[model samples]
Target chain A: MHPADEVLVARYVEEADQAAFRTLVDRHQERVFGYLRGMVKDRDVANDLFQETFFRVIRALNKERGSYTRQGKFLGWVLRIARNAALDHLRARKKWQDLGNGDDGDESAWWDRLPDDGPSALESVQDMEEADLLKACIDRLPPEQREVVLLRHESDLTFREIADMTDCSINTALGRMRYALINLRRMMEEAKRLEHIPASD
Target chain B: MHNGKKDILLHLYGEATDAEELRSLLRDEELRREHAALSEAKFRLDHLKRERPDPVIMDRILAAAAGEQGLPSSTDRKDRPAVARSARMRKVMLPALTIAAAILFGVAVGWFSSQPGTAQVDEPAVATAPDDIVPPESLYRFVPPQPVTPASTQDPRLAWDDSAPLMDMHRRIESMRPEGMLDWGEQAVPLESLPGSGSRSLQLTGSNKN
Candidate 1:
């Protein structure tokens, strides 16, 4: 949550500042945890990967003798860590399969929304419908296209960064983005229309 | 009407050479609607990011990496092959190390040759230190000079080089002396002393051998 996580991170390395580290964890844990959950689809697996991300940071911090590079850009690097952890987990399991719906269910429908506020609205039900529809649409995409869309759009990473995080080239990243957009259009046109949107159950 | 150039939407998003032309293509109402629809669908897909992770599984990952995965920590960083480190070092160290090793090998050969009396040394050379380190003044100290013992009987090989020609010259001189001309029963000189006198005496003795 720090505007620049680098400073507190650097301090956390230099000094064994548990408070500083906790601050960092508290700030970014939600988003990071959310990301891993989105990736592996299993609650246990996502949590394991999330814990491993911090463990790796600690190990790298301690082993390298108390020096750290914030690298000005932190989320991309952290996401790369999460992405690698998921891939490695997948590889170890010998199950190169499509990502599944994660535990606690996916609420990705909050990412790109036109902000809504009604005078007496207890909830904005359109968002939930959007989230459910988005989930179905994502599930329907080819695995590669699906991953590219998730990493770039929902994860809010640039295409080149996604390429690096996913172990692909920038050009491949661009191509995937292009195809993902084209496919999104096709999938939307195919979805059956409902007369009235349902409120959240 | 779908402009034949609808593919240019990707270029407009990317760094295409013909971006202005793509923008012009987007001005068409049908293509514009299609683009808007594509954007909306993408936005819908992009927003699905509010997933939560189960807490218990996170504990295990940290535990496993911490070596509490039911095993004690192997804290030593030794087992990992230096492949990654060497790969990282290749940028600066590989060439520098190569040049340094070459210089060291050259210096070693030069020093070995110049240390005087290496011909008498029978031991094969061994590398004593790293190739990059310049040997201190003390490095040559261990290469003790072999004690040059003067032979009492003389090596036949040394004698072949030193005393053989002189002996032959002495015999020839004795034959030429007509006997009783000098000591040793036939005026022959000692085989060892003639060449020991110097090159001038050896040449004279050789000339007189006939």
Candidate 2:
């Protein structure tokens, strides 16, 4: 029931309507931010990349308004930009290898450094911890697998779109997602099992 | 054929996997177990905290949008004092500069029009040749024929005499000739051999001398 992305994009491009652009940013900001955060494993860096991604989006919309074919794929387009921005930052900082499995010595340091400001309620705290654990597990994934999981879960892109964006076959994209999910489930189960084991005095 | 791990994943993600193929894959205990684990993982991923970028970042992006559209962005003005000042100056000076330019243009047009030899807009244009070049004398030598005088203003002797005899008129016309020559058809003959020509010639010569 929401206004189509094409309508909002047309309003923004033709009328220079800032509200329409803001609407667009609001609609996809969380997805893009989450995807960037997952990719870079840092909130501040994700914020910067988020801003950069939108800046690139605004500039592209203004410069090449015709390039967006208005097929309701605006989120996918924005996610692609966000992914590229995150990858560029990663490459620049020589952190690309760090995103692979067990390569970086301090791969878990960023997760430990994340700010803990969730709600104080017991259930909310548990949920937050679980979420944090899941995020850490996702971070431990290989870059390709993490990318597929983030694009699929956060952006809700189809495997075909993920493949197209990531330059792989659809089957390869699905395979990556399969491995990522299997790894995450195993890690979560292992963490739960460890939580149940009693410690000696 | 569609019971591969990728097909299971595609079916798990709600992609275009066949319903029958998915049912058949789930019938296998191991594949079903794998499906349940992936489903739990995907559910956790879906429930993962969706982090929004700081609102300040959104404000900056909107400000950029405003700037690109040539609209004023009040955001971040405090941080960019010089840019804010320049923008303020532009807002105040732009119209003033435009008015000054317009006044200067009007004054220029008026000054040029008031200069000597500059044509006024209201006057009808006339095409005139330049005065420095003198035309050939032959252009001035052509005199228009004189207008004929009315009989009342002409000398009586030179007036047409409609009632006079044809021969008398002819002789008169012959006498009025510049030299004593007679019209003999297409040729002019000297009147020296005519009977009265000798005396008339002497008289004409005497009158001419007089």
Candidate 3:
């Protein structure tokens, strides 16, 4: 079994171990990036926020080596920071029209920007298509619902943890998750219905 | 074992739920259907793509962790020139500010010394006697003292007689004492001249007198 997150954090903080820090980043980067991507709905902005989030993590860990006493909840703490970074980006984008520019306009813009090496086989391509569809549906969710879903799935946090991170009641977190699932189901059914509609001659 | 949606969710997500509650939830047709749909939705959500950020971003973060670079800003590459310019300005402005502050301090010191009434502490103190000496009896009459010249301008060779006032005050206090009080002048009293002379002389000689 690998060392726990707290052990890795201790190694990184006390010893200034770059390898330990890299392990932390690697262990959590996909979850963090995926959560950010779901939050912002823009790959490039998510990339920026991902970097910003880890940068903040490093700074906080270095400056406050003694302050990280949240023994087993490292990913939850990091996701909270990531959530704030994504929200700040979104708020700034909303405040200044010129900040995001054309980036925030088309949610599907990231699809076009996907790397050319993606999913060469037919089965993988079909899976990618289904993922893309589900992502679009997730993007269509209300911010609160999407946040609940993303934090739950990406970070694997409990409803109580998500509630604490998002500053809501545990019941509220559960309610949002329930609504998100219901909405996703509805949207998937709607998409399937539309896919089955025959083209006009 | 009555199951609410939250209980169903807790049971669904593998959060701690009663086994009886889970069995009851699965037993109810409506709750079971709801659970099935939500489970399907969750499964689909799990299939959502996970992407990694560019390795360059990680490198920058690690470099910041290593203290080789500053905190990574969101627009690092786009704002590098501005950052560099700011750095160059800081490098030039810091020493310039130190020199400017030093010069300002020097000018302030010079300007203050050139002012008329400022104390010249290093110059030897000049001691001058008062223009009019008051007699010891007149000390009680509150004489309005003369305005003394600044130490820097007074004659350094004249030594101040500071003890004159103190001696006068001592004489005034001595005159205030009651007239009949025994003056224990500069000599010790003899034991034979004591109030109880025999007992006092015996005590002093350490002899018992019956």
- Count the clashes in each prediction: 6, 0, 0
* Cα misplacement distance, residue A115 of candidate 1 (Å): 34
Better of 2 and 3 by DockQ: 2
Candidate 1: the clashing residue pairs are A47-B58, A108-B47, A108-B48, A108-B49, A109-B48, A111-B47
Q: Per-residue error at A167 for model 2, in Å? A: 0.1
Q: Please state the i-RMS of candidate 3.
A: 4.7
Error of 3 at B2 (Å): 9.7
Q: Which ten residues in a row have the lowest lDDT in candidate 1 chain A?
A: A113-122
Name the best candidate (by DockQ).
2
Per-model CA lDDT versus the true structure: 0.57, 0.74, 0.74
Cα shift from native, residue A76, model 2 (Å) = 1.8
Worst 10 residues of 3 chain B by lDDT: B122-131
lDDT of 1 by residue, B30-69 (tens): 7676667666665665456576446555455445434466
Which runs in model 1 stand beyond 4 Å of their true positions? A64-69, A97-129, A193-201, B1-25, B28-34, B54-210
Please write out the lDDT profile of model 2 over residues B1-210, one tens digit for every residue.
Answer: 133666788777787558998888888898888888888988888777678999999889999987743422235434677887799989989989999999999999998888766764433343353553457885779778898887635545545554568657766765655453445664645545544566534454345654
Candidate 3 runs further than 4 Å off: A64-67, A95-128, B1-3, B72-210
lDDT per residue as tens, model 2, A163-193: 7888766666776777678778877877776
